[model samples]
Structure formats: C-alpha cells, structure tokens
Target: MTPASLTDLKAPAKLNLFLHVTGRRADGYHLLQSVFVPIDWCDTLHLHLRTDGQITRHDLTATLPPEDLCLKAARLLQQHSGTSLGADVHIDKQVPWGAGLGGGSSDAATVLKGLNTLWGLHWPTERLAELAVQLGADVPFFIHGRPAWVEGVGEQITPIELPQALFDTPVAVLKPPVAIPTPAIFGSENLRRDEKPAIVADFLAAPKQFGCNNLEEPAKAYSQEVVQALEWMQARFGNSRMTGSGSAVFAWVDTLSHQRQPFTPADVGVSDLTQTGPWVGRMCRLIRQA
Candidate 1:
C-alpha cells in the first residue's frame, strides 16, 4: 500500500573535496572535475501526499523563497510522471544556504525521492536522476546518493568507495554571514579555467590532501569573508580549502590526537565564532550515503 505521508526524510549536504574547472563549452558552461561526498549535516523534510493536486512548502526553521527548488522538483515530477498526486513539503532547514553546501539541491532530490514512493511511481534511480539533472547540477548527486567523482558541468557522476580512513573522518565546515553569488565567482575574469584533469587513482592516492579548488581564487576575490574564513580554518586545523564555489571553507579535524574526546563545535571555538556574527560552523563527518 502506498503511504499517504513520508515524514522525517533527510536531505544530506555535500562537500566538494576538490573542485577544478577544466574547460568551457561553446554554450558558456564550464567543464568541471571534482570529488563530492555527503556529510552528516542535513536538512529535514516531511512530505504529505495531497490528492487535491496542489504542491506546497512550509519552512520550519528558515524562511525560503516562494519558488524554492523543493517546489520546482515536486512540480517537475508531477508533470513528467503525469501523476495527479501532489505534496505538502515541510522543510526544517539546517544547512546554511549559499555556502556551497548543496543544501537546496539535496532538498529537491529528497522531495523527488519521497514523492516517488508516496505516489507509488517506483521510478528507478536512473530515471529519477535524469529528471534531477534538469533541476540543478548538484541535484543528481543527491538522487544517486553516494560519494562520486563528478565532471562535465556536474552531469557526469561515477560512484566510488572512499577509503575507510576518510569514511567517517571529522571535518569542520564554516560559513561566513554573507553568501557569495555563484555567478559572480564563475564570471570573474580572475577565474582559472584551464586546470589539468585528475583521475580517480590520482585522488585515491591521497584522498585528504589531493588537489585544490580552482574556484577558490575567484571566490576570494569576490568576498573578503571567504579569505577570512579560510585563514581562520587554517590557523586552527593547519589545512583549509574552499568547497565548491565560495564563502564556505572546510578542514579535516585531527581526531587521532584526541581519541579520548568526542568531537564537538566547542573543540574548535565554533560557538564563539557564531557569537561574533552570523557565522555558521559545525563539526561534521563524511557519510557513506545520503
């Protein structure tokens, strides 16, 4: 029997372990190479099936724009599948937006997944992913639900098993109060667009220390906060890099040294950072699946 409601669905955020712009297409889309992994931090969603054929969204924690991705995703699935069913989506937004964390994309993917079951469509992941890519470059990643090597304007995804050492490693993700517009960074004249393509074996050789985010230089140019966040993370963790486009930086925390203690935000003064402004920080770990 098809359930009328699917509650407490999780939409996990992703980190671009390293992002590189390899080239540009004649259409103006940039070719990319990156390793993407799901993180423990996520947004919670509750979906209720609506027989009246009306899709709606209610934000519980943070206010979302009227036409957020969740609404678009649900509507797309409805139109593509020609389903009479609609959904009432409730989002408990936790992951900060414009942080390069793929929060909106994850939420959209989760809505598609939830509605697939609620409406009894039972579409395969591949079929759903085809629709997902139409929604956003990052949406398909969440639909596929695994760590992947992404390329070709984010449409190409090849799932890979990460080393056990990195599977659950502690990571600190910090976001400044301001959001960096993705277009600003991508359109900047300073952006680098000719990085050498990297292979899976190359990344697997040193998963944690491999490669750099080609988007970082342009991002730093757009937002001084990005520079500050990167420097702040570097000061504490000794290594820091921007994820995806900009304004959010992350570093792998050294857990081996403090094996006796459980990881927390206080360990990295995240609370103090938050008090200083609207800075958002969390101690996260890599999740095997979304």
Candidate 2:
C-alpha cells in the first residue's frame, strides 16, 4: 500500500567545487569537469496523489515560471510510466534562482523521486536518472543524491567521497540580484573552451584549492554584480570562486592556515555586504550526501 502523500521532501542545492571546460563538442556543447557537492540550503516539496491524471503545481514561496522543470518532470514520469495517477506538487522554494545553484534541477529531481514512490513505480535510481538527464544536465546529480565528479556536459556522474576537511565545512554563498543568463555566458567569444582535461586524482590532491571555474571569466563580463560578489567574498575569505556559471559566489569560511582562528559569517562581514547591495547571503555547510 503506497502512501497518497509525501510531504517535506527536500531538494538541495549544489556547488561546483571546481568547474573546468575541457573542450567543445560538434554540437557546440562544452565539455566540462567539476566536483559537485550538495549543500544544506534546500527547497521543500509536498506531493499529493491524484487519480484524475492531472498534474498541478503550486508555488508556496518564490514564484516559479509557468512551465518550470518540476511540472515537466512530473509529466515526463507520468507519461513514461503510463500511470494514471497524477500529483499535486507544492513547492516551497528557498534556493535562489539564476545563482547557478541547480535549484530548478534539484526540484525536478525531487519531483521524480517523490512521485516514483507515491505512484508506486518502484523504479531504480538509474532509471530515474535516465529521465533526469533529458530534463537538464544537473538533474541527474540530484537524482543520485551524492557528491560526484561530473563530466561530459553533466551526464557522466562518478560518486566520490570527500576529505574530512571539505566535508561539513562552513561556506558563505552570496548572490547578487541580477541573474546572468547561462546562454549569454556560454556564447561569449571570450569564454574559455580549451582547458586541459583533469582527473579525479588531481582534484583529490587539493580539493579546497582545486582548478578554477572556466565559466567565471565570461560570467564576469556579463554582470558587474558577479564581479562585485566575487570581490566581496575574496576580500573576507582570502579566496572566492563562482559556482557553476553565474551570479553566486562562495568561499569557505575558514582559511587553510592551521594556526589561524576559524571565521564565521559575522567575522567575514556578511551583514556589511548585505547592507551594501541587494545581496542574498547564506551560511551553509557542504554536505557529504544530498
């Protein structure tokens, strides 16, 4: 007997510890390599089963686009599974959009996972992930619910364990009001497309100070806010990097110096930064698993 409702399903956000662009495909898709880890900041979802075969979504927090990924995911699963059961999905969005935080993809993945159980599909994670990739590159990562080494335009996912120093580390993620369009960043002539390919061993050797985000250079050109956010983080943490592509940048709260005292949001001047502009800041921990 499957439950009619599943409430409080969480859709977590992810950070690209490191994102590299190795090459471009014939179809103009850029090849990428990155270590993606889930964070504690998340969106909450509530799902209720329906017998009338009508899928609906209600936004509880932030307003989503009319045809957001969550609705698409539910329709995709319902169609693929040939299930007459439908769902009324209510999303309590917390993760900020256009921050390159994978919020939409995470919500879509959660919808698929939650509906799979509610509808009694009993499909394996692999099956769910297969559908995930069709929706977006980042959706599969959330479906797997683990820290992963992602490559090849975000389809290839190899789960990896993080070192203790990186795991559960406090991070300050700051996002400006502007949303940098991903296509604009990718289409920019200045975007780097030929970074040398890296391996898991290379990242493992220095997870904290790994390879840089190839997309950041192009992203900065599109938005001065992006530049400001990066500068703000770097000033406080001594190092800051953009995650994925756009408007959000993050830094580990504590520095690498073993003798240095640990820092928190107050020590890093989060309040001052927020006061200066329409910046959203969160003190989050890097989770080992989603």
| Cα-based lDDT for every prediction | 0.88, 0.88
Question: What TM-scores do the predictions have?
Answer: 0.94, 0.93
Model 1: CA > 4 A from native: 60-63, 255-276
Question: Candidate 2, which ten residues in sequence have the lowest lDDT sum?
Answer: 258-267
Top candidate on lDDT is 1
Query: Residue 66 of model 1: what lDDT?
Result: 88
lDDT by residue (25-101, candidate 2, tens digit) is 99989899999999999999999999999999976444457788999999999999999999999988888899999
**Position 43, candidate 2: lDDT:** 95
Question: What does each candidate score in C-alpha RMSD?
Answer: 2.0, 2.8
What digit string (tens of lDDT, one per residue) describes model 1 on residues 1-290?
99989999999999999998999999999999999999999999999989999998876444467888989999999999999989899988899889999999999999999999999999999999999989989999999889999999999999998999886578888888778889998899989999999999999999999999988998888877788788778877888999988677999887567434554445555566565557777878899988
Superposed Cα deviation of residue 37, candidate 1 (Å): 0.3
